[model samples]
Target: MTGFEGKTVVLTGAAGGIGRDLARAYAGRGAAVLLTDLSGEAGEALARELNEAGGSASFFPADLAQPEAAGLIMEAAVRTFGRIDILINNAGFGIWKPPLELSVDEWDAVLNVNLRGTFLCSREAAKVMKRQAQGGAIVNIASTRAAQSEPNSEAYAASKGGIVAITHALALSLGADRIRVNAISPGWIDNGKFGELRPEDHAQHPAGRVGRTADIARACFYLTDPDNDFVTGINLTVDGGMTRKMIYEE
Candidate 1:
């Protein structure tokens, strides 16, 4: 494992499916983790467990929907773990509805969490990194659904599309400050805790099997490595070639 010794990482959605796995993966590499989630108790428990296991971790509670939550989480991270080296904006939300059927509130909810929240976290992290003169990495967890047609998913799709845009835009703006920003478009990752995907979801993919939390988490770890300074402004598709599959008319 790449040693992230003494590196501090702040991860959002740390209590969720992929988020939890990402936290463990980072800690395993010797990084001190600041785990944030809406579930206060769960986040605390997970952080405590990692600490007890000889890894450094701390729990921070925040509702990503709130504008202040992002700043709060980052501030807490800096206070607890010192300067942050990596930030994984992995908090995600989705509501299945067609454009016409989607309520404005639903659209705003998805955008607020998936897009605005990412903006907040990265903005705060950039300020810290720029001041410290230490380059940092940010990994935004988008989804394959961004480019594909998932019926009744207008809001989610738009939000993810925004992530791809945000990653590159921020990457360019932050490049001068020595900060790298990238996004990961995950496939159908079956965490067995939340979310859903029938067997049919996997049959169409070239991988022939649904992805797991570990797959996405592994990618996040790589993107956030301090030793990795060359990679930036990439929307990495970890969707098992599903995006390239030819689904021509029969």
Candidate 2:
């Protein structure tokens, strides 16, 4: 809706499939979007595309794993858009190696980018939001794996679990400032290659289909809307009810 007409949104991992859609969704809603990703080329391209389509968007290249990157990105957003209205902690990756074979370094890498980066970015954004005296929203991209998991997902699962925890903590700490914090746990999101998925893939979920980037985008909008201020400190699972179904093998 036009609710975000004058808002400023800072999104991480802007080059990925879901991130790209997120950028477009905000920009389409009349928000000034500052997109960041390690892949400068992709991020810049997306920004350019949005601008060319008559939307306000800028690109900043930064590695979220670096401690200094969060501050720099927040500064860039303020400099470009004047203030930060929203921060989407969507940058993360998983190293799917068996626990026995997974190195300590690999574990650190996942946690650094996924968990640590979310906290640092949220902290920097909250500072600006507090100063503005206007409440804001921070949505951390967690995953269903936070509560449930499969083999070889130790690092990824742990990072997501941490995100879910940090979300509530931030919510309580920032509640006084009117800054709402929440997390979204997405499951089986089909970023691309939807055509290749089989019938069983869609049937497996109770909703009878996989999720799309739009699903997550809409959820973000709902959480960040000013009217939804009461919906903070919770994790919204947007997985088409896949997480609730009980499947039994015959």
Candidate 3:
């Protein structure tokens, strides 16, 4: 139960579908977490809910698209928790657009948040984790589109593809410092009622429903455990076998 006790995690996009789940899951497991998101109110409310439930969390609102936002959130987490042992690059943007239909600005925006944000957060986390006598872990949330993509997914697919590359590169770069890095690509996340969808949205996943926050959360917990010293530079696909299914089921 205390696998993560006393550990501090900095999670970006903490107000979004998967992000919110991650914040609660980590806090529930006794991790002190800093939740960063573009929505100040939502981030704060989520943190408040966790704290009220006996978990530890604080909101640090920041937009990953901004150049300074990633560093700012890292600094805030360290200031609030004394140190950060986990970094979840969970904030990202997905704009489905064909090559001709997609705008340059839109492409840039998506890449900046999805790709650049991951880079920025990893860089900052690497710096702090290096100082710790004990090392840390980093989990980057990508999409299943990186493997077998769909139409109008140029920007998003590219961003996620870049994520796998970065995971390998950073794993090699940070292994010397005892920091491990990995990525998870979630497919058809059936995040129920995110914004306005009904519970039926959960049926959208091939696993008889959409992906659960626990699905990804479990992976994150496994990869970050103190005993998990040998696992690194891996890209796990927790998409309910959707990506591997060749036939469309009824």
Candidate 4:
């Protein structure tokens, strides 16, 4: 937060959920935020709200599934803020059908948005960051399913797994340019409608509650901050000890 007073952050999936929280957190810390999402209406509203609240913010509507969209997103961000100091590749969705019932198009849809989108955005941002000579950071939003998953999540799991792999590969490729790349695998983050969760949900986690959007947002700040220069190429799992817990039927 200390180093972000005048920085610029380009965040995808900024219409709602974790992406929304990340936008707010970055703006609250004085970063000029360029928010992008498929839901243009919501994204623009959030941007207007943030600007009204005395934060620098703008919105660009994008469909990450399209290959060319990522480049345009980076272009818009640079045009609006002059440069991109951070890139959050968080625009993604999942399909919950059983593997047997899944269609080829469905699988492709998930991969296109989740995996290809991350690559496109990171590639473009890296190019810009290298030119800037000031270095930058990239945070890819993977999922706990990348390492461990339940039924009916084959496509989602594979996409997230790819995210972790690319994080390290990009880190190595971009380290020379001072662009750090990392992934955050969040577990059981309850981004449901308000009041839809119950006490058991909080009690089930070893950390005493399910994950929050702010939890991931804070981790992003830590990993991206220039002070933590040596912390690249790592997949930081932010699960509330759930992944470590062993379960059995009584």
Candidate 5:
């Protein structure tokens, strides 16, 4: 938080949910935030709100599934803020269907947005970070489904698992350049209605509650913090202990 002053953070899928909270958290901590998402209306509105409230912010509308999207985003961020210090790959969608029922188009869509997009963005940012004296951080937003999953979630699981693998791979490749890369696997984060929850929902986790956007946002900050330079290539699970619990069906 203290070190983020004047830093520039590029956050994808920042129009809503965890990405939106991340944009706010980084900006609130004194970072200039570049918010990108396919939803231009909402993304632009959030950028305006942040700027009006005295945070340096801008919105770049993009569909990360495209091959050129990532490069364009990084270029715009540099043009606006001069440099990129942190990159958060949070643009993704899930598809749940029986393996036999899933279509190739659906599978390709998820993979392109979730995995390929992350890779493209990280590659572009790393190139820029390598040229600078001060290196940077990249945090990929994976899901707990990568390690544990329910039926009919093959596409989502594969994409997230790829994220974990790519995180370590990038870390090893970029370490010499001082660019740290890591991944966060979140479980049961309620980005929907927060007030409409039952006691059983909170009781299901050993942490005694479901995850919030702030939980992931704080985790992002922790991984990207200059003080935690030694932490990289690790998949930090912010799942409230649910992934480690064993539950037997009644």
Candidate 6:
């Protein structure tokens, strides 16, 4: 945990459930965290909370849909923390509708933020990390939907699938620079409604419950840990074994 002491992390989509916890995890571990999101209010509040608790944290408002946002975000991080040691792409949204009704605009919106944003941010961070002697780590927050689908998830699935593809490709390209790239595909992570989940909901998962933000946070720590440098160019599924179980009606 203290391994992150004195490190700098840039995290996107940091106002939401998973993103918020991810921000805390990094800040709590001694990383000077730059939290970015569309919600400036939330981002600022979280940053304030972390700083009040004696952790180094700051907030930057951004809309990944904008082509210029990535560069600005990376700049803000470097300006605040002096260097980029970790980048977490955790910002994404989905537009669910019948595939026939899913307009090109909707699809574009999803890809722009989920897939394109991931790529742009990684590229910008890599530019900085490459200059540093130790290099850095990038963890893209993909989803289980990248591989499995429920219904009417074409755009969402496509974006996540693209994340996985770019993850390995970036890994291969950045290996020589000592920058490790990886992806985490989370399955059914309960944001804040765990109390409302029914018995069957927990039973359905092979792990006996829905996943928490902490689960993905732990995975992030593991992947970015310098000791685990051997781990790269892979997608680690953090689902509660839901992807492994075969579901069928009796």
What's the lDDT for all of these models?
0.88, 0.94, 0.88, 0.93, 0.94, 0.95
- Ranking according to lDDT, highest score first: 6, 2, 5, 4, 1, 3
For residue 76, what is the lDDT in candidate 3? Answer: 93
Listed in order, each prediction's TM-score against the native is 0.93, 0.98, 0.92, 0.97, 0.98, 0.98
Looking at model 5, residue 90 earns an lDDT score of 95
Candidate that would win on lDDT: 6
Worst 10 residues of 1 by lDDT: 193-202
In candidate 1, stretches whose alpha carbon ends up further than 4 angstroms from where it belongs are 193-203, 248-250
Error of 5 at 75 (Å): 0.2
User: lDDT (0-100) at residue 62 of candidate 2?
Assistant: 94
Q: Which digits, one per residue and each the tens of the lDDT, describe model 5 over residues 159-188? A: 999999999999999999999999999999
Better of 1 and 5 by lDDT: 5
State model 5's lDDT: 0.94
Of the two candidates 2 and 4, the one with more favorable lDDT, higher being better, is 2
Backbone clashes counted, model 3: 1
RMSD of 5: 0.9
What's the distance in Å from true for residue 40, model 2? 2.5
Tell me the TM-score of model 2: 0.98
Candidate 3 accuracy as TM-score: 0.92
Candidate 5: the clashing residue pairs are none
Model 3, 1-250: lDDT tens digits are 2478999999988897888898888988999999998966888899889999998898988888898888898899889999999999998878876789999999999999999999999999899999999989999998888888778989999999999889989999999999999999888664654446556655545666667788899989988887888999999999877777776668
